[model samples]
Target chain A: MGPLIPNEIITGQWDFVIALLIGGAFGFVLEASGFSSSRNIAGVFYGYNFVVLRVFFTGMIVAMVGLLYFSYMGWINIDLVFVLPTYLNSMLLGGFIMGLGFVIGGFCPGTSYTAAAIGKIDGMVFAGSTLIGIFLFAEFFPLFEGFYYANNLGNITIGEMFGLSNEVIAFAFVVIAIVAFYVTWLIEKRVRKNMTEYKFE
Target chain B: MNTNSSAKRKPNYLNPYFGGVLLGLLLLTTFFIAGRGLSASGAVKLSVVTVVNKIAPEHAANNSYYSKFIPEDGGSIMFNWLIFGAIGTFFGGMFSGVVYGRMGKLRIEHSPKISKRTRIIAAAVGGLLFGIGSQFGRGCSSGAALSGTAAFSFGGLLVMALMFGIGYVFAYFFRKLWI
Candidate 1:
């Protein structure tokens, strides 16, 4: 009964308006959480801070649980919601490359924009180069087109892949995330004590 | 280090878990209303499509990837909701920055040992790589790694795992840039 837009319960210009509002909230939370700082983001890898991992995992678990609950309560129709399609080889390679970028750049597309908005020159540079990178991909699409389309898994969920219930998978994920949080907290404390150069700004 | 003024002026960030919870709620609300999660890189793809179509109408129409996004009716590709959402992200970030007193003159962020020029180049190159990678991966951090994992998509999980995993794998090599 929910997913008002796809179900036509909400239509036309108002849809885009709501999208803007949602995006606003998304961006606001990101910036307010210190995502506007490149140093904060890079801290996850260095062990001086684990803000990125904590925020990301918490958000994922919370949303996942919220969706399952909403569907169970019949407040929303989960089937109508969009699930990102899978392209295995492309994603694995792409993710690897992006990971390298994250370490070097200290920002992702979304976070970089937020940082740029707050006047971080590095953030602005990263954001600008993204457009160029995208353009390059489009320009050279023919070369890797086959690789991109390889191993099409077609809208599969992890629950289905592992033959687990969504609830079960979600539970497992929550447990893993909590453990990670605790481990990272200890690591961060230790690292910060030894870190003399960078202050958690 | 101007500790007194810095401490007095700089607003403390919201607790990370609280911020994540707020973000999750926002994400959930989006699904409830729009039936989709938040995305950042998808919007950039649209921007790329729009720009290519404008600069070379023929070229955009000719490409396999670009043509997929080009409207049959020849409308603007920029009309997508993701673009609007991204614009909102910029404004929202700005608003938050102002509230937190984080807004300031443009400055390149880097480690003390690194030259500003080196950091800028690294950021640009890193961004370039991420942009291309997102196209291949179908999304970036928010769309693929975060939202996808939430939806329990295997690709999402894989991307999230591989991205962070590989980052750790290679972090030491790039430690100079950060640490």
Candidate 2:
């Protein structure tokens, strides 16, 4: 019933307009939460800042619960929602590469763009290089085509794959996220106290 | 530092949980309306396709990956919703910066222990790596890790775990860049 665009309830022309508003809110929240700062982003790895983890996990669980609830209430059709397809091997390697990039660069693409918008030179550099990096991938696409498209799991959700209810999985994530929040909070307190350089605002 | 004002108050960020909730709600709204979550990197890939097609029509038309995005009917690839979304992200960030008073002259952010030039190089390298990785992974942190996980896809979960897990594993090796 929902997903106005797919159902033709919302005209095609309005799609881009909706995207802009959604992306704007996405960017606004991320920036206000200090995601525009690379140091704050990097804190998740060093234990001095768990803001990234908290925000990511919390946002995730909220979306998950919201989706399930919407579906249950018949406000939306869950199956119509897009689930990212899985190419197992490629994604694993990709994650590894990005993980290394995260530590060295201290900025992800989204945060980097936001930072660049605020005139952070490092953010600008990172954003530009990503374009180059993507260009390189396209240039060498043939070499990685087999592996890149291999092991496709085909938009499968965890519930469907594991025979668990979506509601159950969402509840588990909520619990895990809360536990992680508490543990990370303690870790941040201990870590920040020892760091003479911790930015106190 | 605000040169215009005499106030020395440090930049105050929104509460993390509150920020996360806001982001979560926005993400939910996106899915409700568009039936797809937000993405930062997918838009870049689209732009890359458009540029390559324009600069070297033959090359983009020949490539397996780039060709997939090239329209057979000669439609413009730049009109995709994701591109608009990316532009919105830029303006939104600018708006937030203006509100928070964090907008400043171009400056390289880095650890005090590192040189500005070194930080620049690091950022360049990182961006390049992330760029390539996002392609392989089908999305970056925002699309794959965040939205993917929310949808409860195995690959999304796997990528999310590995990305964060691997970051911790490699943190010490690159501590100088951050701490």
Candidate 3:
């Protein structure tokens, strides 16, 4: 009954409009959560701030639980949900690169945009660099084409790989998130006590 | 010193846990309506395709990577859903900025230990690497890592693990830039 466009429940030229509204909400949340600041975002690694961890893990757990519940009630069909396909080697390599970028740039694509909106020059530079980086990738696509399409694993889920139900995995995630939150809280308190340069805005 | 002084007057942001819940709810709604999760890097990819198509149509078409993005019927690449979503992200960010009194000024943000030039250069390099990596990984933090893992995707978990794992590994070296 849901996933309006894909299921023909809400067809027509309005799909893009719906996507925009959702994207807007996504952006608003990121900005309001202090993700607009590079220092705030980078603080996750330093333990001065753990906003990124809290929001990211919480959002993940909430969505995971929500989807499971929706399916249980038959409010939405889980079968129709899009699962990102896996390219094991490529994903691992790409993720490593993105991590380096995250630490170096201090902003991911989504956060950078919000930071730029709030007038952070580093955010602007990060966004500009994203565009340039993408351009560079496109220009040299041929060189990496073989690896880009390498190690196809299809659209498999963690549950499938682990031989567990989605509910079990979701439950584990919640537990892990809770533990992470508690531990990070302790760490942040200790780290903030020692740090003299950075201050919460 | 000016930056630190300005930061003092800024209002406190929402509690991280509270903000996380809000963000989680927003992500849940996205799946309920659109049947997918949120993304940011895909939009940048769309822009890249659009630009390449405009500058060198034949070259873009001939390239396997760019060709996948080009429409068979020949239309503007900017018409993509991700591109529109990115535009919406810009507006949404701006709207939040307006509400929070965070807009209307622009300046480079850097550690007192580092020069503005060093920070800018690092940002550009980081962005360039991230852009290329997203293509290989099939998504960045938002697409592959966050949304994918949320959906319980194996690939997503791998990306998330590697991304954060590598970040921690490299964070020490980049400590001067940030901490």
Candidate 4:
């Protein structure tokens, strides 16, 4: 009954507009939460600040739990929602590359755009490099095409794989998030005490 | 001091927990309406497809990866939802910057220890790798890791865990860039 565009509940010219509106909210939240600053985002990896971890995991858990609840209440159809098909080998390899990129670049694609908007030259450079990297990948698509499509698991979910209900997985994430938030708070306090170069500003 | 005066006027960022709750609500809204979570990389891929179609339409049409993006009865790739979303992200970022008074002349942000040149080089390299990686993985952090994993997608969980795990593993080597 939902996913308005796909279901014809909302159609014609409004689809793009709705997408923009949602994206605007997404960007505003990221920037306002200090994601526009590379230092702020990088702080999660360092023990100085755990804001990234808190926001990211909290958002994930909330969305997960919310979906499960919505399905239970018969408000939304879970079957209609899109799930990215599992390509185990490529996902692992790709994630490793992205991890390296995150540490070196100091900005993800979304955050880099926000950082660029706020006049960060590094952010602009990163954005440019992303375009170039995509171009390069396209040029050599033949080389990695096999690996990219390898080990397809047909949009499987963790619940299905692990024999657990979606609710249980969501609950476990909530618990994990709470523990992470608490642990990181302690770590941040300890790390900030020794730091000489960085400040909250 | 002059610095102290400037610092006093600078807007304070939203508290992390508060921001997280708000973001979580936003994510929830997205699922309810769109039946999916948020994504960022798809827009970038759309941009790539559009560019390729323009310069080498034939080649782009032939490539399995690029062709998937171009509609069979093609008109303009710029009309995609993801492209519009990205434009909105730019505006949203600008709006936030305006409210916070963070808008100003462009400059490279880096740790005091690193030179601007070093920071730029690293950023470019990192972005290049991410570009290629996202294609292979079928998504990036926002698309695959966050949204997919939130839906309990196996591939999504794998990417999220591995990406963060690898980030921590390699973070120490890049300590000077940030810490």
Candidate 5:
């Protein structure tokens, strides 16, 4: 009954429109949540703001549980859903590089896009740099092509790898997120005292 | 340059928990319809491909990275789902900014301790790193961390962990730019 595109319940013509609406909602959520600010995003690291951590983990667990439930209810075919493939070494390398970027740049790709849309010059610069970076990668892709394609662990999920049922893992993440939310709140309180530049409204 | 999120007539940002739930539901809906989660870097990657193809047709044709996305069926490489998603994201963000009154002016966001030039350099360097990393990481925070973890992908989880974990580790060195 779902995954309308692949199942052909919703024809190919509607693909672009649906993508637009979904992306719009995604952007709207990020922007309204204070993700348009570099400082706001960086707060997770400094402990002045835990908005990023809270929003990120909450969204993760919610989607996890929702997907599990939808699959349980037979509302969607789990197999048809796209699972991000794991390219171990390459991904690890990638994540490492991106981590540096996040702290230095203060916003990631999605957040940066929202930031740019909201008239953030830094966000705009960051977005433009990504284009240049990609161009650099494409041009020099041959140098690392061997390494990039080296570790291809096809379409595997955490629950499958750990031998835990989806529900159990989903519940674990929910617990973790709850604990994190509480702890971060406490941390933010202590940290904000020293931060004269930022105060929660 | 002053964000001053103080008590103003402007609309305040929504609660984090609510925003999370909305984002999650949106991701779920996206998967429910397109069988994929949201992403931003993919669009940028394709955009690069399009530009390279236009500027240096022979070079793009020969390059492995650019050639992969050129479309054997003979059309613009930009005719992909994520590109439309990126377009929607721009307008959606703009709409929210206008509604919240957060978009009247353009400025560089940084900590008071850091100079504008310092902030700009940091942002450019950081963005440059992300661009290259996304190519390797397969996506950025939204693409890999948030969307990846939600889908429970192993590599996605790894990327998420490493991205945040590393941020925590190296944050102290770059404290001035943000803090």
Candidate 6:
């Protein structure tokens, strides 16, 4: 009844059209939320603006809870949904490198694209660099080929990792996110009071 | 540049909580309809493969990396879902910009302390790291971290934590670029 494309409830060019619409929603939400600004994004770290933390955690928890409800209602087969495969060491190393990039560059791949779309030169440069980085990785594929495929944990979920049900974990996340949001709001107030260099744009 | 300074004082963005709810619902809809969440880096990867395939057909054919994306059907790699999603992202961003009056004018954003040249250099270097990292991590923030965490994937959680954790650790070092 759901996952219309995979379930054959809908077929053909419709999926492509849906992809565009979904992508649009994704982009609009991101840009309208002030994600197009590097300063706004960087503020999450400095505690001046907590928009990134708020939006990111909220989005993740909402989807997590929604998936549970959908599965419970049998509206969609949860098993059919794509769960990203985990490769421990590879992701750890990759995530670390990306973290450095985020602090320095001020945009992730998705956010940067949205930034670039609105005529931000910095966003455009970041996007172009991402291409160069990918090309470099491909060019040096032979060197890291072994490491990339190492630590293959296959498709695993946090529920499996923690031996808890998805609903329980999601509920826990909701609680954690609320606490974090409250704490960050407090921190942002304090940090903004002392800041003379950066202000919300 | 000065015209932009006068064109708009500031953009009125939506409330974070409201925007989050909308984003969350969109993500939920994606899972319900497509059996997956959103992504961005995958499109970039595809474009890289396409370029390599075209520029050096022989090298791409012989290489272990580029060859994987070279379709046996000789179809366009850019026709995939992620690429289309990215294309939509462009339009969606523009739509929001126009509506919010945030569009029009290009500028290199950076701290007043840093020159435009320095800002561009830092951004490019940062972007390159992200690009290479995504390949290793299997996705970037949107794909691997955000979507992955939503789906309750272990790898997603790991990437999210480590990425943010490292960002905080290194943020101090790169403070000048932003602050």
Query: Comparing to the true complex, what docking class would candidate 2 get?
Result: medium
The top-ranked prediction according to DockQ is: 1
- Give me the runs in candidate 2 sitting further than 4 Å from their true place: B1-10
Stretches off by above 4 angstroms in model 3 are B1-10
Model 2: per-residue lDDT, tens digit, A51-129?
Answer: 9998999899999999898998999998888888999899999999999898889899999889999999999999999
Second chain TM-score, each model: 0.93, 0.93, 0.92, 0.91, 0.93, 0.91
Displacement of the residue A79 alpha carbon in candidate 3, Å = 1.1
The candidate that achieves the highest TM-score relative to the unseen native structure? 1
lDDT score at residue A128, model 6, on the 0-100 scale: 93
Alpha-carbon interface RMSD for all candidates, in angstroms:
1.2, 1.1, 1.2, 1.4, 1.5, 1.1
- Model 3 Cα displacement at A47 (Å)? 1.2
Give me the candidate number with maximum lDDT.
6
Number of clashing residue pairs, candidate 1: 0
How many residue-pair clashes does candidate 5 contain? 0
Q: What's the DockQ for every one of the candidates?
A: 0.76, 0.75, 0.72, 0.71, 0.73, 0.75
Ranking by lDDT: 6, 1, 2, 5, 3, 4
Error of 2 at A76 (Å): 0.5
lDDT of each residue in B75-104, candidate 5, tens digit only: 878888989999888888888898888885
> In angstroms, how far off is B106's CA in candidate 5?
1.7
Candidate 5 DockQ category?
A: medium
lDDT of 4 by residue, A127-179 (tens): 78888888888888888788888888998998898999888889999999999
Over the stretch A37-95, how does candidate 3's per-residue lDDT look in tens digits? 88888888788888899999998999899999988888788877888999988888999
Deviation in Å, model 6, residue B40 alpha carbon: 0.6
Worst 10 contiguous positions by lDDT, candidate 1 chain B: B1-10
Chain A only TM-scores, each candidate in turn? 0.98, 0.97, 0.98, 0.97, 0.97, 0.98
Output DockQ, candidate 6. Answer: 0.75
Q: Residue-pair clashes per candidate, as listed?
A: 0, 0, 0, 0, 0, 0
Give lDDT tens digits, candidate 6, residues B28-51: 999999998999998999999998
Q: Candidate 5 on A1-201: residue-level lDDT in tens?
A: 777788999986688888888889888899999989888899898999899998888888888999988999999997888889999889999999999999999989888888999889999999999999999999999999999988898899888999987788889999988999999999988987798765442
User: What does candidate 1's lDDT look like per residue over A63-83, in tens digits?
Assistant: 999999999999999998888
The TM-score between candidate 2 and the true structure equals 0.96
Model 6 CA deviation exceeding 4 Å by range:
B1-10
Q: Is the docking of candidate 1 incorrect, acceptable, medium or high quality?
A: medium
